[model samples]
Target: MRLSFTTISIFLSLIRAPGVVSQTGLAPKQFLNLPLGEVKPAGWLHDQLMVQTNGLAGHEHDFYDYVAETDWTGGSSYYSNLEEAGSYWFNGMVPNGVLANDATIQSQTQYFLDYVLDHQDSTGWLGPEVNTTKPRYLWGRYPFFFGAIQMVEANSSLAGRVVPALHTFVKLANTMLHNNGEGLEDWTNTRWEDFVMTLQWCLYDFYPDGNEELLLDTMQLLKSYGDPWEEVFKEEYFPKTAVENLTNPFPFLTWHGVNMAEGLKALPATYRFTHNQSDLDAASLGWDLLFQYHGRPSGIFAADEYLAGLEAARGTELCLVVETMFSGSYLYQVIGDPKFADRVERVAYNALPATLTGDMWSRQYLQQQNQIAAKNMNPDPFPTDGSYSNVFGLEPNYPCCTVNHPQGYPKFISNAFVTSPDKTSLVHVYLGPFSTQTTLADGNQVTVTVDTLYPFSDTLTTTIEAAGAFTYRVRIPSWVANGTISVNGAQAEAVSPSNGLHSVSVAAGTTTIVLNLPAEITLEPRPHGSVAVHRGPLHYAFDIARTQKVLAQNAQEARAVDLEFDATVPWQYALDTSSLRFQYSPPASGVLPSPVYDSGLPPMSISATACQIDWSVAGDTFASPPPTSPECTGPTTNITLWPFGATKLRIGEFPTVNLTA
Candidate 1:
């Protein structure tokens, strides 16, 4: 008999490991990310995702040809697009959100799921086998494994098939490794090998019966071939040298920004399987080094194919943004680290939005932190990126970002709330509007509704409906200096979030927890003595007026209409740092409107007195922030700055002048 999704969810809730499997390698009792649709995104987050579904992710076939396949799984077409389409189907656009019950989404997503589950070979290969005539091009298999993770997370009915299939595939792959050292080839040396480790750990977590032997054997196999990152990082980054002077011995791993970002989770995953403190240290050190030299104001590392230095004009690939986000999501689940969640939020709030059009119709292949133009140029700011790298259009330079970008928003929303290992507590990781239903370890079911305009307004309220009492934990960001929590109406004096999390006993029958998170504005020093402004999690940038020019249909792909944005107003401004102040316009009293862009009618603005500096342009693009302590050239003027994502073209990192001095 066919059962409802809610019924299936309840059944899965009761289905525990016979003893305690570490096949997934994650300690389920510590933290559990709910199924994809269990926690639904609402408010502006919901609206943004809806726009994406209607814009490109929903109608992907209308614009691109490769991902339009229902049966074709050949390697000739980029498989990342299909994987991306699957993620979009499961997470954001298709089966959930505004189009939750849409028949087209239901059929398309179900067919894709069926394709993998029904077409598995007797040998247990999941997706289409590329190069059947020759040895499997091992590297290509990794993405399907990566993509399968979303399926297993979203569809409970498929777990029985997916889990066993994963077991068969990993064991087969392991055997192939033994026969001729299959995966130990050149491409496997890159961090992509980490997926094997992750997949094994997932299997280990799935089977309570214990597959420890197979797990360790696979780990050892990958370790022999994968990048010897811990040793290389410790030697190259020892004494933790400054970023600008740091040179990577393995240019293959370090120079490729997306690879570097994707590799960040490898050590963290290693720590999960081995519980090695050194692995954890390596993960921590890796983060320290990335932000030191190649970091952008948007909480991403600079890479326009290579690790460009910290000049804001240098570009960051959109692929790296989504990949790093995916890495952080996994890292947080395995280690229960709050810092990983914080990194996720910084990228989500700043970089994700800045790179996409407000309507989600277009995106940049590479976006600059101090961008003043988004047009094609003779010499792109990115040394390796193509001419159309900065164009706000569909599939500007490559199709990778277009296919990969959909996972960021939906995954962020899915991870907003998670259950503790024992299922007696709920943890609200990121600030967003969403609701989730989960069964506690004690067999009581609970529902949580998060209500707020978080990352915009500081106030957040969560209402709990449950059959019994449970511990409700709220993540208090380190950036929040004055955070307070109240239950029902009385202040929860016993709850101190000094350790980044606050837990309080939430009784059944509509218990409400109100959080007051106060933010403070501060100037973050940037490269070459410039500074990017920040208030709590949001980055502030000069709101520049943009005049979009539709580029002449010059590319071979005539269907791909590109756009160029020109900043009409003067962008060479140096802030009078002392005159900065913020004036907030709170959300309207009842039923918040469609999408609020950080403010209302008068427009919530951060005003400061500033003067035009001698900052010039590099070709048509805004030049790098004038070297340390720029000298003013024009009289002081009042200027407004808004959240970095609100403006199409912005000066995010700016030079500063001591006007009084």
Candidate 2:
């Protein structure tokens, strides 16, 4: 059922299908997403993706039982009690395989896609659940198709087969929705937005032929049955304190951290269909409240399982980190807000990498901002998580993060650059080393190349080549106070950005525009009178030397082992903020290290004067919140801090020291 690439492209162009704006009068998207592989990673980003390919992300399907022997591939049952792990792996692996263009990964992806498509039942139900009286959970299909559709977009040859199969499933989904959402319950009901998002993609992009009304109806019905995220986001319903501390029986679904992350864009996604202002307002309010109450220094909200509090010791789940990145990217594309892009970069650059090892083999189920050690915690801070939750392992406390973490950077690369609705312009939403090629509305072939260390280095060089002139927009992060842009190395001019984006009239042919955004060291005040170090997008953390012990080894890969880390030196430090200095040492060979996140390889660090403080561990496991105006217990000495993502053991939030005290 596969169609040739030429046929699919022609078919897409001829369709008057509701793209950004559907025939049902949906609101137009501010920015449109490019296909999966259109934006390619380069430089440090490329190295990072390669490292992911050589690590768990690329090999999960080969050895991981959840993915390797899952029911999605004709096995009897999923490894985990929840049947979504295979889908998670697929959702992540599709982009990684397509973006990396790795043969082995691509083959694995094709094999799974072939099996799933071929196994579709006559009832139009996808997956291995069939003919049992047991309640069917359609939630797994949401992530599965999320990856499937990307594969279709990346490799258009899958369009004929995948599109029709998707259309069939939509028909069944619409039927089920009409019957009061038979299978939509619990988690599925709370997370209906994921299904709605997929439906919108089909209605707008694929032209579900005569099923437009059906798709629209299904979206409305799903919203009616789904969690009232819009209503819950209101000030009264939104929990200001930690879920555990609240006396009222708060809707756990609303407070569940991963759900909050995925639900952040739920109303915004609904706004596209309803075009209601309240939906948009509610969406924005939810974003603010989530962070205001539960936000961490690493640009993620505390949700070790449910919404934790603002305390630095509270753990944030790895699933929440990647989901927040996705939701932020979605909000930026739909709402066209620069702040959303900034948040996405913050999570990607700091929290995402901080959760995983440098090799991407091992990962923490939960990461703490003031983490001093990566070991099983007996009296852990997380209200809903277990002891192994904070340890670095293959499956630590839960398998969800293990299967789900792969999508973080791969999807980040996919959404790095987006096109304007009319296709007359391209916007660099999230700055990184990537390039994009797309045809503009005027029938001009445009290629944009961005080369820079970005987030680590302040300079970004963008080379634009087009058959004709077009508008080029680069996002000016909220952090940058004075950014400069030069045309072809000409005299630099101050960049006056509107709504956090600076636009330039790019002429035809190759033109190099170098942008310099100088950032000054700043301090973010935290709870308990502690402060976090920040310069540009990277968060600075005190690099604590740690000794790692392999608790267990993976049967498939010896290198992929469960790790327990203990700080070798003291991690209790109070910084003298006045003495902080930013340092940059470019690579001697002018090449970034293979694993950019490896400690000391980032080539950028901060030197500051600090002294060991009397900070003690909570329950002798996690570091307690920084003491309020604590006296220094040791002599002051110069200390070095690395990027938060570079250090596995670190103190991201430090107490301020008063030398005269």
Candidate 3:
């Protein structure tokens, strides 16, 4: 007899009554995620969406039609390509759908929802029917997990339609666990269980009463099947001393760059249910180990395939950067640590923008800290990724980044605002131009509108609209010292230094707060005696002129363009450490194009004196030049540096010379 979803069927049937499933579950009280559509992107972030609409993410059907026609049936056994397109549409499109007020956006959202609604099997299985031979291919269902979460968070009616399917899918999944776990063995394939655990826990929180036993049973089984994140970190299995680390032939399965990025939050997310201290410790420890040896100034770790060492010339995958950002968002929710927010800001501001064209039309799969060129070569610097990995195009080397990159900015906007457990305070997890509206515990409506060009300018203004008094919490980043907060033009004392939240009581009606976090330039020492320049969260690089080449577009796909960039200007420059100047310009002040990314225009630029220093190139990529004294062979000239995100060929980590030393 075939196994049946007996446990799940009973749980679902019991909860058919209205209001039986409560909107509460095992998520910790301190981490309350606000409903979507409450906070919308404004200013430069909104401009980014306009640019994205012209890119691969907005026209999903144009570039990724495979997903549109797959019909959620496991076509070729890689889970469901439908999930990929669905995930992007749900995350990237919905935000634009609501914000842009475009009909196409709503129709696109409905396109995915309709398939999910129409195709759910009688046994409650979601997505394409599993091909038992390639059963582990179910890893693709993880995208559906994301899509479901976003749907429930954004729309009540849509969520109402989705919860029943989710419950049924959970039951079907639980039934599969009873049969010796056929497809859940491999490390790479098994990673999907982490998503399952997370979705299950989130659903449990929504329906806590009737389905406790079944949810726990499924979760425990997933935990058993997941990669040994706890043990791996405890034993320091990563950053392995010997190249032959894992005895298995496919060691990259465990040490893969993107895998590690997705896995970073796995344990912390599980901690939501387990509440185990060791799980929390594993998340922190694993982060430290990854950063200690492979970290870059952009707040990402180097990984051409695996944990490449801490050299400036090495590249990190674009997918890893976005995944790390997602992980950081979760860690912040779970741990409430400001440091996680710091990571999120660094990647969003620097690494993410650096990899893609300003217009969001094209992107590279791999971005290097000391990249001097981005052309296609047969023998690329990457160990495993192809030569085209650095090309800016649609699906250059991997389609995963193309599909996954859209999640970063939209999710970042979503995470900008959250409330304290007691609902007496609202926290700004990230600083940008956005407004947050949420109700307090005392039944008071509070709305805070944040206006500023942050990371571009230190001056931020917050306007509070509330009739009653409540605490307002502002995050003072750890890097900012002597930070000042002013209310209604009155200067307040510096409250916290270690990335703490500074709270102040407000008098209800239209209170304005101004925050001044002065940016200071600091030189960070890196591997091979190189240096990275940092001012606030943005990293400064020696900007090299780019030679743009438009490789032909796909004949089959509409407007799908391929691009390659070559370094045109001289890249061999060593900075004079003592002479750095800050130049500020408001948006659209320059002759550059409207969208900052589209024109490679930064809202602010830094002027620094530099002299041509001796640097070598190895196989068309920049080599780590040795540190030298303040001797200059060429005349001292001033070079302008925008943020790392605004440049395609940039020497972000440079060899510095100290004249006085």
Candidate 4:
């Protein structure tokens, strides 16, 4: 049923839903100051990408010991293992904006490189690894080999062949092929994801390997996964109501997660050679649907171990958040869609921060939008009533989310800027002096230096050396007021680039632009039901520990129960808007477990003046709850009523309050 007017007003007034749109395009390459560690947070996020790589790094042996080694099964792919690996792999790369650097960052980086060296069969397919029993490496094996190619591309000095990774991949691929008529595994063109796999394979397939057998098999495979990634990721077989199981079954959805980035495989070749529309569309939909059905306010899916129906509370793993971001960036670059980029930023900033505590000491194995408490962490975390509101500390169940969560921030810093096709400067994110001597779009050795304190303040200045009428695009968040762009300090209107990007011209000399962001607050209701408050991209919660609750005057006991909202401290989040205060409190004297008051419920509702806002939402009924589950608790007992978003056992739709004589 649709929301009534009162509920709609509350929902429309408080809720914050991110528009389904993209952010800006490329930032000035130099703007991403990677050396001085100004972007340390983002790099930390990147460190997570090769989480398996770093897992390998944590060990003396690359293949043997992985970070989540005991728990993570990257090889057991397209299954639970695939869900784990795909989730983590997605995080390890994207959120952190992984640079294709050497082994310093990831341990599995070498594993992939070595897998290529060791597994190269007589034929061409590098087949990242062998299923000896099966024909292909489980999960997206092509991306596995492709992962090595990315690392090698970052470092040219590590040489052998430009396509050494491909050489190894080809050998293994050939071993599984039809050797004259006795097809090795009897695989006489048993068609699978050859096109998607070979999209990355073909990048090096064209590189000249003496082995013709391996080459032909790859060509056959390349034609398989043509360009469905963009379309397929967004395309759903059924809607929420259409599906029988509201939650996805274990085995079936795992396949969807691994092959999630099928379309993005075409980017390297398309960027290097062809402008394929199919490639772009495939990449777009691949990322779109993930956010659509599974996205949380935290910028991740409701997947503890796998993708859940959208808005389902007990979902979203740190591993998945990181990997989704990694894939999101790949899609963004390939499709050049700004919306994907925007998703990257929002999730990186808000959701990513809460995943790992500010100190980096604690992490949740699984993060949830309705999460109010941290529970036991293990292979997967189980959420209960208590787990909703308590923000105590690091959980015990699945500690991988803890160890792996730290990378979300550092990786975000790394992802802030990407290499432009021409490889010039950087894309400006957050704002800071970014310095790097990378190759720009013009093939010239372009060195860029940018400096700004962004988000905290809004004036960015950049210095470019590979002179010409070089154009740089700076993203102005929709939150900001539109203003004129100033070159070398003169005001001029800058052209809007992709979705959220602004284009500005720069000369050899320093060009300064005053990017303006206006401080304005807006609201939109949730797609499902209920209302949530937000300022900008930030969600608001009633910080109970910080505020006062209304109490009875005859309260002699310190554990006073009869409480209500406080009028003294207005809802700062509302700005000029005001909320009516309840003059009484819940009859329990203080917060308690299983807060069922007003009827046979434990929390007997009584209206009164509030002691503080933080202690409780200082207001009356937005809309009355239908009725509480019948329970009999003794009278004069204590019960806790946490703000809806703050505590797991919160009562947003409270029982009706009546005045006490």
Q: Which scores higher on TM-score, 1 or 4?
A: 1
lDDT of every predicted structure (CA atoms) = 0.69, 0.84, 0.70, 0.38
lDDT, candidate 3, 504-615, per-residue tens: 7888788999998886888888865677888898888877888888886876664667787778878777776688787877755423344675334776777888877777
| Model 4 vs. true fold: TM | 0.59
Which one wins on TM-score?
2
For residues 198-252, what per-residue lDDT tens digits would candidate 1 score against the true structure? 5643566654236667766666566555665674455354323223344454424
* Model 2 TM: 0.94
Query: Model 2 clash pairs?
Result: none
Whole-model lDDT for model 3 versus the true structure? 0.70
Error of 3 at 404 (Å): 1.0
lDDT of 4 by residue, 410-478 (tens): 445554555554545455543333454544556544455655323222345565565444666665555
Per-prediction TM-score, please?
0.87, 0.94, 0.89, 0.59
Task: Please report how far candidate 2 places residue 552 from its true position, in Å.
Answer: 0.7
Cα deviation in Å at residue 88, candidate 3? Answer: 5.2
Q: Kindly list the per-residue Cα lDDT of model 2 for residues 1-661, writing each as its tens digit.
A: 2345575455434431333333364687889999899998998999899999898878887777788744444555553322588789889989998889898888888887877777788999875653345666778788888998899889888888888888898888878877756878778877889988888775555656777777777777777767778766877767776778664232357678888899887898899888888888888888888888888778888987888878888889999999999999999888887878998899999999998999999999999898888898768677788988888889999889988999999999999999999999889999888999988887989998998988778999999999999999999888886889999989999998999889999989989999999888999888999999999999989878988899999888776799999888888889888889999998777678888886787889999998988988877678888998888788988899899999888899989886644
Ordering by TM-score:
2, 3, 1, 4
Worst 10 residues of 3 by lDDT: 15-24
